[model samples]
Target: MVRKTLISNKAFGFLFLFIFLLLPSFISAQTQEYKDYTVEKGDTLWDISQKELNDYFLWPKIWKENPEIKNPDRIYPKQKIRIPLYLLQKEIPETKPKPELETKPEIVKEKPVEKIIEPVKKEYLVNKDILIAIGYIADSVHSVGKITDSPVDRTILGKDDYAYIKTDNPVKIGEKFYIIRSVEKVIHPESGRKLGYLIEILGIAEVVNQENDDVKTIITDSYDEIPTGSLLDNFYEIEPPLAFENPRKPDINGYIVATRQLHIINGTWDIVYIDKGKKDGLQVGDILAPTLQSKHKIINGLIQLINLRESTSTAIVRKCNNSITKGDGITSVK
Candidate 1:
């Protein structure tokens, strides 16, 4: 009896040791696996979760893992996302077999259902406001000229009218140019540096003939009077209208530098130029809030970016509670 008891005790000790040794491997095997997924254009967090994890509601799980994603609705292409192994290995449950029917019932007539079609809404990046904004920016000209002569000494030139301009630079016949008048000098609000001269486009003209220092041009289009000492620059083409995408706000803050309207106060649908642009990571359709600085920050309006340049951008006011004007601070939309 003593020998049997000893053998039993030895077996129990060996069993406990085996379980202790295999416990770590079992826990390690139960741990979740991870995989990386590269984001593509037009991909959204919800869509990605649905496609990769087979669960669209798990988008928050993805966002939790990637704290860099500040906005779940505004993710850019080429971003990397981590996916879990359980989702990838999930299996569909098998359907149970249906019981056989006992007997066939009488046939019944069914009503036809009506199909309803919904109209698709079209989205646009460039609208009338955007075009006006572009025109305002294009009004600034570098090359200059002066009206030398016109038929009957006409001070104002219109469409289909011929005017002779004197410029120091050579003019190529058949080239088109814009006739503009200097309006004001734009200076950087912060640095006090002279940015450039803002001008008003008076008319468009095509060079019909070129003399030694005189270029005869026929006005093709005119918005205002084209008089003597009017500046000239190469014609600028307006970019084609584009559709607006889901835009992400820029990380930097700026302020309104100029407005297309001549008035001091601006409201809804007005085009305004901001000091930030592509260099600041601003994109078309990105919305910004305009705030007035006094004792405290007062939000006055919302503006959506429609056109972008190197150091500046054009935005159209979408909504306004108070009048917006130059010097108002602008920041990324929250």
Candidate 2:
């Protein structure tokens, strides 16, 4: 009975020792599956989350993986840390992330990962209100209505004046038309090519009375003189939703064709028209650098494209080194 008891005690001791010896190796083997990282100077969990996953909000998940990190905010240099790949599948924006782990973790035998792609974002430049108000160049003018005559026999129209309008198209009672006039025909200075007519927005008119094709409209607002022979177009007020500031450098070039105020010399806050436009990979919010040809390229100022057409763009001078003119050479810039 004594020998049997002694044999039983020996077997139990061996079993306990075996488990104790294998425990550390089993834990280490499991940990080895994940890549290891050592904390460095100026390292914060918040920064780590963004640097690793492109999301600063995921710091708590990273902290949960590192149980030894008693205080997430109090990490030290050379401190060994385990920042495991927590999610098998994650949706994140495609960004260049700098991971503390120098190498890509070969953490196979785990759940598979799925990465989703999202659209890239752009920088906002100007107010849409100001953008829509800026005049743009067009190849042709299509007027839905025309100002045939005015009440009280007024030759020159101003604000709050009644005008008789006629259109072949259907006109509603509340429909609005923009009183615009062809100010001048734009001719390319260098090439001597006829670009288009510059349609100036004089005022806004709203239809109040309509009898068959004869429509009566009241000039709601006027910026310039609205003559009797002025043309009426559909009211345009929407700006581009994707119009953003240009972040890329100059790859395409164009020339200034006209100015918004018809100024011979344009300065800050002046809107100018450019020859390069949407067809030339130009878009709203693109920054253009106006340069002067000399012994060296002279950068006069910068312009931000507020409107883009097929072959023309309207840009507001954001910066003015000297003065931008009608024929200044332009190149796209950040």
Candidate 3:
């Protein structure tokens, strides 16, 4: 009886030792499948997700692991990224996640990993109220010249009963002066967000002569400050969702919302300044559908039918139009 008891104790001790030695290796093997990645030029999270996980939208999952990817906008070349692929697959039901107590942990025999893919996201159109900041186009130093077209002098002359601006410098017959207004956002019908502002051409003045940087100037026309509720920018004009019937003809499509006729920059080729910006869901490389309009007879009424008037002329968004105004043209509606 003594020998039998001793034998039973020995068996129990051997079993406990075996389990203790095997537990850590099992856990370590299960969780050791994650890898790291380096971001190269033109590397995008969506592309990497597609290559690694076969789903582009799954990028947010990888982004959760790396909190440093703030402002999904600013990515540098050759940045390192962590790719987490070690989690065991639990079949998440379509409706809700399984409760922890209800699920049993299963060991993975092997870890499968995929190479990262860099995807190019197409640009998309958006319109929203955006904040506009003013900068100096040209600065004029003081010039002591005759002030013929002073606003106070014009009031004295009874030329017109209105407030006018004047300066003591050289003046010309057809010069233009600008009353600049800042930009802001409005409501969007599609996305339900307020974005972008409308830049308005306020007034025109002309230069008479130059003293130094300062010049004598006269107001040619008195224009009002762009009032509130003015039609600011047009987000929908990035691409008219229509096609042109004739490809050979030079088609006029949408209306111009804003323009920088004087300043042409890279990425602004043949592109008109728009009212819509990134706040309106606009992206950098979306293909916009150009369209046209025609009057058609519907049931018992006259309806304006917008037609897809042309082939898809893709507009690469160089910059978001932050100051779209109402009644502004998007593109030629052909």
Candidate 4:
């Protein structure tokens, strides 16, 4: 009798184990799923976003989802596409008993593995006048000192009694100056003239010595404002409303890849290096159009917050960093 009773109890335990394992799966009732799509010729990103996402402006999201598309404008015929679907589920009550508290697991963030590849380097084609203007603004806003002019051409305001600002010059006395070293692409909202990213300030030099006409060394750093050539001026304001008025036009794109913060090169006042070079189809003298990252929301959807999303900053490929790798900023409108 004792043996028979023991066998029956063992059978009950097995049945309970099987039921417990299958219960959660049956209660959740989730299954894998997918949607099929047929590609049509001349289907631009704008077209697909309008059809799939219901918002024509959401083309960026579609392109981001499908990096395989390559260019936003290019698509082929009869290409098979898979649309991702995020399932909706209601939160269920916890049923499992709480176990004894244990030590937390160590959080280790794995760095992305980047392949070692040679980057293409090309000479920049910056305009001398534009660089001058950019440099002027950079100094005035970010650096300390004033740019002054004399028969000597330019000089930084100095403590020397002989030195004085030529008011006739574009840069006035007590005005600050900055050197425009390089340009990088920034993003604007595709719909309007707005910034889509943080405004970046890279390299710069200060107006130092102002008096000597024969030898003018714009102080790379100084506490006093002096009339000098190191003092540069911004011919125009670097704002979206003051700049791009149209959305359809192709904008310059890229990000600051490297910088010479030390002000080593004579011309490298606030100089910034861009990822885009000649190989990815960019010239050195190219100027960047910037856009600030914007926020978004889903008006009416079950899982809008969780499913649909917006991005802060994305690189525009004004200059190709080569190998089409990460950290290479892309093109944008100025």
Candidate 5:
């Protein structure tokens, strides 16, 4: 009887060890499988979420899974990240029901009602002319003159300030010119070739005197601070006709290449640079819609062409469901 009991005890111990060794493997197999992703250059949480989870708004879920990423904006390339299984599985959490609450009777009081008449507010849509008038569409191909000197010791010159300009080009006395500075280089979106320089209007000046290569001028109107080396160009005074009368969509399709402030993200009233221009048959007062590339291309915003160059144009954001960003496609619209 003692020998039989010993053998049974040894068998039970072996069974226990076998179950302990196999338990971990069973648990691991039952768990959901996660895909591993290696981060690449120019990768952002927003973009990764869009690529992995099919929703750009799910960036927070990605951030929650990677606790080591303290700053979601500063993630580096070559980092290994696990795309959570929950995101892939599309698991919906079970919601708990609210407990029933005791109700109390409320007292109602009757009062005399009066009819109120409110004035209707008129809605005004933004037009291309308005954008040009507001200095959002400053573009000039004519080379003016550069400010060489200012009357006062101040660095910035304004209206009524005397400024000496130097230009190889001839300027007629009493002729008004726009003071501008080259700010950025505009590039083609697809070919990535340099198109032209974007000039910013600094102020306005009129030629007071002409002597050799030097032209004496006085700042007449200032939009921004007029500094030395500001180039002078022919003032654009004629306003293009507004297309509100007969608006029509163009057949040409393009994409946003840049913005006025050179921002990656933009919203309503912000100026954006498009690949389409006069060469592409885009004209002033042409309206375009900014759209996202999806299974069913959705337009998120509206933009109006205000300034057209040879191969590019500047547009003002008229309306947007959300903020417009770089890489958003553009299509002409009525």
Candidate 6:
């Protein structure tokens, strides 16, 4: 004979109440329906999301619901995945019977109000003017116009100097463009990837007059001596940051490929170029530190990204006990 355990009336009442409360959620889960999809050749989760969910960015949602998917990028043929229809499709409105209203006496209770403390924006070490001069590397810069010649017989141009810009594109009066020089291309030391080109900001120019294919402009702001044949593009607005924004990938790391001024040895306040850029989720106001195993650990310091491009970023050494060298690996601190 099977032995039976006796329960008290009070214990049975608690168990009944718990089961009564959880019964609705259990029933609701059973009613929830999920559409199934089979992975086919040449089909990516992103493409599948767009076809099924009507949004490409919602692929993560589909990936989350399916635990078997080992990798988001790699889904083999004949693999089955479930789509959460509640997230994919919109809800249909339903009408229900309204409850009858009953009048009741009002009662007021005094409660403590909770307060949320906001973080204050901290000013960055460098200002806009300094940032403009400390230009970052980019994959490519689309030059809209190029300086052809100047009214004065001079090799280099400066502020208040009038120059003729040649371009097939249309020009507008009072329109402004950044005067820049394409220095050279930078390559990743370890990855061997073409990071981008080094672009130096020379100055700013404003369109004054247009004659056929030539647009006459006056140099507005001169950071460095502008030269003939310098390319003109839209000006970038750089501002001093409050506190450093949290790194998109907290553990993201990259190499310090090069240093500013091509120094044989680098120290604090020196500008360094990182291989990682916007593609790697790096952004302005991000703080980076030399990895523990990186060379010159005694001189390792923190670097703050001042500017970013598609393939690279320019950072300033904000803090360090010693110094950093090219090829030293750096990781996000915040």
* TM-score of each model, in listed order: 0.53, 0.55, 0.31, 0.24, 0.52, 0.54
Model 6, position 194, has a per-residue lDDT of 80
- The best candidate by lDDT is 6
- Estimate the overall C-alpha local distance difference test score of candidate 6: 0.72
- For residue 225, give model 5's deviation from the true position in Å: 2.0
Better of 3 and 4 by lDDT: 3
Q: Rate the local accuracy (lDDT) of all candidates.
A: 0.69, 0.71, 0.38, 0.36, 0.68, 0.72
- Candidate 6 residue spans exceeding 4 A from truth: 1-125, 212-214, 244-249, 261-269, 279-283, 291-299, 320-323, 332-334
Model with the higher TM-score, candidate 3 or 5: 5
What tens-digit string does per-residue lDDT give for candidate 1 at 91-160?
7565797898789889989898898987643334543323532344432467656677786688767778
Q: Candidate 2: deviation at residue 161, Å?
A: 3.2
Residue-wise lDDT of candidate 5 within 1-334, one digit each (tens)?
A: 9999999999999999999999998888566466778999867665687788876445666776787875554577899877888786685676797888978869788797898987642212232223333333234355745788875656778778988877666779998887877777666656787756666666778888877766788887765567787777777674444334334468778887766542221112367777777888776767789987555678886776667777777776756787777667887553
Q: Indicate the worst ten consecutive residues by lDDT in candidate 5.
A: 260-269
Q: In model 6, what are the clashing residue pairs, if there are any? A: 122-242, 122-243, 299-322, 299-323
Error of 1 at 53 (Å): 33
Error of 4 at 158 (Å): 56
For model 3, the stretches where C-alpha displacement exceeds 4 angstroms are: 1-5, 76-78, 86-334
Report the CA-based lDDT of candidate 5 relative to the real structure.
Answer: 0.68
Best by the TM-score measure: 2
Please give the RMSD of candidate 6 to the true structure.
19.8
lDDT of 2 by residue, 236-308 (tens): 6764444321244547777888876432111114778888877888766566788875557788867767677
Off by over 4 Å in 4: 1-34, 87-334
**Model 1 steric clash pairs:** none
By lDDT, the candidates rank as 6, 2, 1, 5, 3, 4
